[model samples]
Structures are given as structure tokens and as C-alpha cells.
Target: MGALQGRIAWVTGAGSGIGQAAAIALAREGATVVLTGRRKEPLQQTAATIKDDGGKAVVRPGDLMKASVVGRIATDIEKAFGRLDILVNNAGLNITERSWRQLKPEGIDLVIEGNLSSAFYCATAVLPMMRRQKGGVLIHTASMAGRVVSPLSGTAYTAAKHAVVAMSHSLNMEECVNGIRSCVVCPGEVATPILDKRPVPVSKEDRAKMVQSEDCGDLIRYVACLPPHVCINEVHITPTWNRGYVAALQQAHVGAGKK
Candidate 1:
């Protein structure tokens, strides 16, 4: 039997990228996965892929930016599964504005609402169920920008990611006694669709050198499968190439006028 043979896991932003990969990975481990995203078609695609692999999955499409929708999702999960063993707060987005001077109020709100507020709403919504079970795992997909500022990631994105890390730590401190574990993953750069949102376009060659979504999926699966007694508080994953450090330099020198 798989390590998560009877577990129930819900992954937000499960349509594409890291979220989809993580949901599939958990299902592969025998968890009944719940896939949630803004788009129904992509969520259905993820669910179908899981079913194709002989794993169980279902799709729940909604706008996570709304606290009410997030609450409804938790309630729906409770009604359908009666229990949730894992919650992956993986929904997030960034804007093309890299600096505060270039950032607009609407852009900041979009980043904050999509990245930070959504995570907060989802975590709060599920905490009661997790506490009642007296054992569960919460995984937040923060960014390397959380640990340090990156010119590539905009100010709003960086601020929101930093808050995610802080929130994860706070959850651990407050809820570890309740048998709840919270882990924040800080990845430098991954070949996900989010890269397309960057202010400066990344070359295919550069993207190839970055970490892949599956790599993060594997890491999250490893973290989730550990014994209940073990709590991985935070993890920092970066590709061997460490492009976040060099991306700025490359844009200035190599990518100039390259389109």
C-alpha cells in the first residue's frame, strides 16, 4: 500500500504548474486528491490525468481570491470527504511590475489578494478540520523571493511571498501542539507558466536551466509522506544554475533587444 493510502489531500491552483504536479503526485501515493482552480477545464484535465493513472481525483473550480469561495470549498470538502489529511496552498500570481515606482495600486492588490490573502483564507478555513483530526499537513508554495528580494520578481510578489513564509512559521508555532504541521517551500525559479508573467521574458534556454514543476512536486510529496512526528518547517529549493542571481545580469547584457 502507498504511504498515503487513505489520505485526503486538497491542492489549490491545481490546473497547471506546481499545483497540478503536486496533486498528481499525492494521488500517485494513493491519496484521494481534490483539485481546485479558477478554470474548470484545466482542473478537469488534472483530474482526468489522475484517473488515467488509476488514482482518484476530483475537481473543484472557484475563484480563490474570495474568502467566501474558499470557505465554501472547505465546507464542501468536509461534506464530501469527512476529513482532510493534507492542504496544499499553492495558488499564487505575480505582475510584470518589478519596482515600487513601476507598481500600480491595482497590481499590488492583485498580487496580495492572489498570493497572500488566498493562502490565508484557505489555511484559516481548513484549520478547524485539521485541528479536529489532530493531525494534518499544510504546505505553502512560497517563492525564493520570500527569503530575499529578486529584481525579477516584483515588489508586490516579493512582499506577498515573504508574508507567506511568516504565516507558515506562525501556523507551526501555534498549531504544532494540535498535531498540525505547516511547511513553507521557497523555490528560486521553476519552469512554470508563471515565468511568462515576468517583466522581462525568459529565454527557453534559461527556463530549461531552472527547476521543473515536477521537481517541486516530488519534494512536496516527500515532505507530505514523512512520519507524523516529523515536521519540516521550511525548505529552500533552487536549481543548480541559480538563475535568480544571474537573471538580472543576463537581462542587462545578453537579453537586450533580443525579443
Candidate 2:
């Protein structure tokens, strides 16, 4: 049997990219994965993939930006699974604007809600169940932007991600005694659909050079499989090629030419 056999894992943003890949990975390890996302069709697709691979998965579609919906999702999982072994807070988004001057108030709110507030709601909702069970893992899919600013990710996204990392640390500090572990994963320039939202569009070649969703999925699986006594508080992963630096240099050269 796989390491996570009989565990119940809930993955947010399971429709595509890292979230979908993580869901599949957890299921392969024998977890009964509950896939949550804003859209039902994509969530269904993820579930189908898991089933095809002889893994179990269920779709739970809802807008996580709403605290009420996040709460309902947690309650639903409890009713179905009796306990949740893992919660992957992977849902996130960014507006196309990178500069603060270009960022509208609405966009800022959207980014905060999508990337930070939703995670907060989900974590809180699952805390009670995890506490009662005496153990659970909470993994947040933060970004490298959380550690350092990047023009590509935009200010709002960076701010939200930074907060996510901080939030994870706080959760760990408060709940480690309760047998709850929180980890923040900060990946650099992953070739996910969210890349399309970058202010500077990533080229196909560049995307190929960047980290892939499956890489992250595998990492998360490893994290989840660790011994109960071990807790990885934070992880930062980046592509070997360092595309962000290369892109910045290229832009600088172009600006020099224009000058």
C-alpha cells in the first residue's frame, strides 16, 4: 500500500496545473482526494484522470473566495470522509498589471481574496477537524514572489503571497502542539496557466525552461509522506535556468537599444 493509503486529502484549485497534478499524486498514494475548484467541468476532468489511473477522487466545486463556500466545503468533506488528513490551499490568481500605478483597487482586492483570504478561510475551516483528529497537514502553494518582489507577478500577487507565507508560519506556531503542521511552498516561475497572467508574457521556450506542475506535485507528495515528527515549514523551488534573471537582462538590453 502507498504511504497515504486511507488518508483523505482535499486539494483546492484542482481543476488544472499544480493543483490538478497534486490531486493526482495524492490519489496515487492511495488518498481519497476531494477536488475543489471554481468550475465543475475542470474538476470533473481531474477526477476522471485519477479514476483512469485507478485512483479515487471526488469533485467539490465552489468559489473559494467566499468564506461561506469554503466553510461549506470543509463541512461537506467532514460528512463524507469523517476526517481530513490534508488540505492543499492551491487556488490563486493575479491581475495582468504589474506596476502599482496600474493596479486598480478592485484588482488588489481580487488578488488578496483569491490568493490570501481564500487560504485563510479554508485553513480555519479545516482546523477544527484536524484538531479533533489530532493530526493534519496544511500546505499552501505560495510563490517565490512571496520571498522577493518580481515585476512579472505584479504587486498585488506578491503582497498576497508574502502574506500567505507569513500566515503559514503563524499557523505552524499556534497549531504544532495540536498535531497540525503547516507548510508554505514557494515555487519560482512555474509553467502553469497562471503564467499567462504575467505582465511580461512568458515565451514557450522560457516556459519550457521553467519548473513544471508535476515537479511540484511530486514535492508535495514527498512532503506529505514524511514522518509525523517531521515538519517542513517552508520550501522554495526554482528552475535551474533562472529564467526570471535572464528575462530581466533581456528587457534591460531592449530598453538600452530603444534609448
TM-score: which candidate is best? 2
Instruction: Tell me model 2's lDDT, rounded to 2 decimals.
Output: 0.93
Report the poorest 10 consecutive residues by lDDT, candidate 1.
243-252
lDDT of 2 by residue, 4-53 (tens): 99999999999999999999999999999999999999999999999999
C-alpha lDDT score of every prediction, in listed order? 0.93, 0.93
Model 2: runs farther than 4 Å from truth?
Answer: 247-259
Taking all chains together, each candidate's TM-score versus the true structure is: 0.94, 0.95
Tens digits of per-residue lDDT, candidate 1, 108-152, equal 899999999999999999999999999999999999899998566
